[model samples]
Target: MTDYNAPLRDMRFVLHDVFQGPALWARLPALAERVDADTADAILEEAAKITGQLIAPLSRNGDEQGVRFEAGQISTPDGFRESWHTYREGGWVGLGGNPDYDGMGMPKMLGVLFEEMMYAADSSFSLYSALSAGSCLAIDAHASEALKAAYLPKLYSGQWAGTMCLTEPHAGTDLGLIRTRAEPQADGSYQISGSKIFITGGEQDLTENIVHLVLAKLPDAPAGAKGISLFLVPKFLPEADGSLGARNGAHCGSIEHKMGIKASATCVMNFDAATGFLVGEPNKGLAAMFTMMNYERLSIGIQGIGCAEASYQNAARYANERLQSRAASGAQAQQRIADPIIAHGDVRRMLLTMRSLTEGGRAFATYVGQQLDLARYAEDAGEREHAQRLVALLTPVAKAFFTDNGLESCVLGQQVFGGHGYIREWGQEQLVRDVRIAQIYEGTNGIQALDLLGRKVVADGGQGLAAFAAEIRAFAVDAPVHREALLEALVRLENTTRWLLAGVASDANLISATAVEYLHLFGLTAYAYMWARMAAVAQAKLAEDAEFCGAKLACAAFFFERILPRGLALEASVRAGSSSLYGMEAGQF
Candidate 1:
């Protein structure tokens, strides 16, 4: 694998040039005093250094060594524990956390970029801290002030790690089916008893304690999702003085040997009457867990982007250096027997597809981060509501589309490597294995598509989509290039959304059948818009920096010409309805 370099240039281009993140930060009162352009740049630089140096070197070793499970304790791969401490010391875990409790208070717009970098450098190592940040968000949002005071600082400091335990052997997406039981105690704490499977960072030797935000049903609670309750269960119970106390009942029964992210300890956690404190309210656990789940959904999406990026970097490097067949036009390298494979049209096509999709995914994710920042920190109520609506509508799309595209990008990167890509030692195949889970976990891509079409679009009558189209149109007006393409794509997205909304009423199975395609239509259009915005910025700055800006223009053009056309096919499939899907009976197969 080629040494990973954090794409700081592209990231800066997206943040400062395309998104104008610094100006946005200056406007938000919550971020005005906390961050600036120089600060963000410095943070990104520091993050790039650590991720590229400290964390990245461990990725190959982590994958090769994986995790060792002996008896009940789980030990991470070599260098992982020390790297975790180094990461913790850098205050990165709290980059976007609540400042009231010692977090760095960076905006999501910036934090998401850092996340992308970390995942790119080392996905397994990144998982340990990623879950902690998400749990911190959930705890800060729903837990009591006392609980926040107790856990947030330590969580932010990385002195402790956190995990969300929602999935069980019998339940995955269906939270209502979870059989975990939480019985009330005399002093208000409860006894959490059950097993939660596929818990990331569930059992690791990196931290002093592990904080598990668990979901369970109370005895007197209602059935299904309504009956669930959120609880804070720690491996080591904390004393009143903010130090470790007695060991709680939570234990790692065993760790799963996963397809990828092997170094990440995916555990079957057995909470045997563990002492736990209730979070939020009884029968409202699903609502509260979403606080963390949604955060994780987006983070998982970034995992795809990160892996795709790493794959592209290695593939691109290999393409340029690995000499093979001669160029069709002529022998580009006269001194060598054959020119580099990168000279071939098919090779260039593969490389461009990876480049366009990965860069566009970065831009799209940054846009979502901007919306998140606006939702939480915008001054006007109208602005906040608008941003929240867009966030709601796009969160699933971001999760599903980015990941689906991430897998595609990674595959293309691997394809660029031809035979070498299939080899494990090259690291291209590892990226494919690692990124596959992004589509499955944190709510499967199919589930995300259904959520987007049924819940976000149809339930709201496409109000959020309409607002999103309006934003696209507004951008199209100012976009120096690709304006017409952006506008046309916007119309197509709006029309496809309307068609989905209309068909869902008449056909019960229509939404689920076409949800995936509908999401792609939306995602393609979103990327087109992102490309247009990027092209506008790049065009304006062309004279100052011709080479960089010119490349941006070329990428945008490639996206518009080659990539955006996929939306047309997705639209056609959406219009085909559920008839074809229903024709296949279970017994017929």
Candidate 2:
């Protein structure tokens, strides 16, 4: 891979110029004292340094070495443990954690850029801390004050790490079908007994202990998902004095030899009567877990962006450097025997697609981060509710669309390398492997699509869409460059949403059948809006910084003319309905 570099200028543009994140921070009372533009810039710079220098150097070695399982202990790849310690000391893990608990208290808008940098540097390395940050959010939001006091500081400080254990060998998507048992103890802690498979960071040697936020059904619990409860199960139980005590029942049976992210341990956790504390209320675990899951969903989406970005940097560099066939019209590099691949039209298409998707994804991820900050930190209840609604509607889309597009971007990057891309030497293949899991984990892309189509859109009768469309229209009025195109796209989205809502009542399978396309349609529109906002900023400031802003305007034009048209096609596919899907019987094949 071309030495991984963080797109700092692009990140700054999206955060400060496109979204005015610094100004937003100034407005939020909680962040007003904690963070400023300088703080964010310094953090981004520091992140770019360590991630590129320390973490990135280990990525290739990590994947090559992978994680080792001997007896019952799990050991990470070479350099990983040391790197974890370095990251821990820097207070990078809790960049977005609550300040009350020793976290840096950075907003998601800035935290996300750091996240992108880490993932870009090393997917496996980023995941270890990603889970820790996410679990801290869940604990801070739902756990009792006592529980938070016990775990929050250590987790935030990176003295300890965390994991979410929900999937079992028998259960993957359907939490309702999980057979894990949580038995109450006379001392108040429950005995968590179950086998949770595909548990990321379930077992690792980097930290003194591992905190697992588990989901299980109590004996007195009702049937189905609503009956489940959340529990805090640590590998090493803490003493009253706030130090490690006896080892808990959580154990890693074995680690998966996965397709990608080999350095990050994906374990099969066996919780054998582990001592656990209840979080939130009885039979209300799903809601608590969602606090972490939703956070992870967005983080995972950024994984896609990061992977695609790393791939693009290498691909773009290779395209400009490697000379093969002459240009279509004639030889551009007369000095060389043949022209560089970048001179070809097809090569330009691939490179531009990678740039457009990667950059647009960065913008989209930041926009979502803006909403998250508004929802959590806004003082006004109305603003908070509006932000929360947008979060609810957009979270799944962020997870699904970013990842799906992330994979495509990575593939295009690989394709740009041609035969060289297929080889491990180029590092493009590794990225392709690493990025594939983003689509499957946290929640599968299909599940996310269904959530968007069914829960967020249809369940509300498109009221959420209507609210969101109004906001888009309001922005479009100011973004004169792509105003009409954005407005037209918004109308198409509203009409398509109405179309989905129009038929859900009559067709039981409508959501499942067209959910993916519907989400892409929404995602395409979202990106178009994002590009329009970007283009608007780039348009007015052309003379101030022609290279950066001009490129933004050009890319926005490319997105509007080329990529945005896919929304119409997605709408058509959604309207195609479930009839074609149902006709294929199981035995017909």
Candidate 3:
């Protein structure tokens, strides 16, 4: 396997050229004084060094060594504890965190790119940090000032780690069915008693303390999702002076033996009358938890993109080096025994597919991160609202489509290695196993599709989607070469939206059956828009940098020609409706 590189050039192209992150940051007062093009570049450079030199080396070891759980204590891989400290010392844990609590307060646009690099370096190792960031977001957003002051700093500094305890043995996606209970006490704190499974970083030896943002039903709570409340439960209670105190009632029951990401501890956390403090209003926990949920959903999406990128880098390097057969045109390397596998058309196809998707995904993820930054930091109220709407509309799409495409890209990357790809030593198969969880967890891709179609599009009357399409249409007008393809994709997306909205109301099964395809259709159109935007920027810069800019244009062309056509099949499937899907009765298979 090739050594993992940060792909800083492509990252910069997307950040500085395609998204114009510097200009965007300049407009936002929160980011203007803090981050500029130079600062962002420096941050990226440092991030590249850390990920490449420090973290990437631990990936294989993390997988092979995994983790060990004994006597309610979990141990990470050999180097993880030291690596976690190094990462935290770099101030990466607070990259996008609030500045009020000693965070570096970088923009999400930059954060996403950093996240991709770290994830690509080592997915299992990355999870420990990612979970902390997500937990910090929830605390910063919904937790009381006291809670924030107490937890945010420690969490941000990596002195203490954080976990989102939402799932139970019985509850997965349908959180309303959770059995955990949180009872109020006289001192405004609550006693949280519940068993949360699949808790990433729930119990680990990496940090001094673990803060759990738990969801449980209140004693006087109503029912279903509305009845749930969020609690800030710490593994070790904090003193008034912000130091670790006695251990709380939470412990690791056991850690699961997982399919992949084995180094990241997936623990069964049992909280028995754990001392806890409420985050937001009572019975509003789900809403509060969603702050973390949304943040994590996007982070999980990046997980997919990251793994795919790692897979592509290794696969491309392999394709260029591995000698297999003569080039279809003739022997290009007569000095060698046989031409490299990259000489073959099919290998090039796989490599290009991986490249186009991975690069386009990078741009797409950055775009969403830009929207998130605007939503939070934009000066104007209207701009904030518009950005928020777009964030809500596309968050699910980003989470689902990026991951779904990420898995497919990883598999394609594996295929480029042929039989060797299936073996574990190559690391290709590990990427497939690691990225597979992104789709299944953080609200399954199917749930994301329903959110995209049933709620974001149909329920909102397509206003958010229409706004997105208008942006694409505007870009198409300026894109001379790719205008037709961009416009055609916009039309397909718009038409598909209309069709789904029209039929969804009449047929209850319609959205469920067709939501996935509609999401794929929307995702394709969005990526096509990204390609057009990148292509326009590349075309303008081709005179100055022929190699880099030309490569961008070539990838955009591949996207429009090869990948974008998948939207046609998605559109057709979406238009076919739910009739054929619901024909079979229960247990018919």
Best by lDDT: 2
Root-mean-square deviation (CA) per prediction: 0.9, 0.9, 0.9
Provide the clashing-pair count of each candidate structure. Answer: 0, 0, 0
State in Å the error of residue 165, model 2.
0.3
Instruction: State the lDDT of candidate 2 residue by residue for 1-589, as single tens digits.
Output: 6699899999999999999998999999999999999988999999999999999999988999999999999999999899999999999988998888999889999988899999999999999999999999999999999999999999999999999999987788899889889999999999999999999999999999999999999999999899999999999999988899999999999989999999999999999999999999999999999999999999999999999899899998999999999998999999999999999999888888888888999999999999999999999999999999999999999999999988999999999998999998889999999999999999999999999989999998988888888889888776779888888888888888888788988999999999999999999899988998888888888999999998888888888888889988888898999999888898997
Off by over 4 Å in 1: none
Cα-based TM-score, every candidate: 0.99, 0.99, 0.99
* lDDT (C-alpha, whole model) for all candidates: 0.92, 0.93, 0.91
Superposed model 2: Cα runs more than 4 Å off: none
Name the lDDT of candidate 3. Answer: 0.91
Which tens-of-lDDT digit does each residue in 176-246 have in candidate 1?
99999999999999999999999999999999999999999999989899899999999999999999999
Q: Which stretches of candidate 3 lie over 4 Å from their true place?
A: none
Give per-residue lDDT, candidate 2, residue 296. Answer: 97
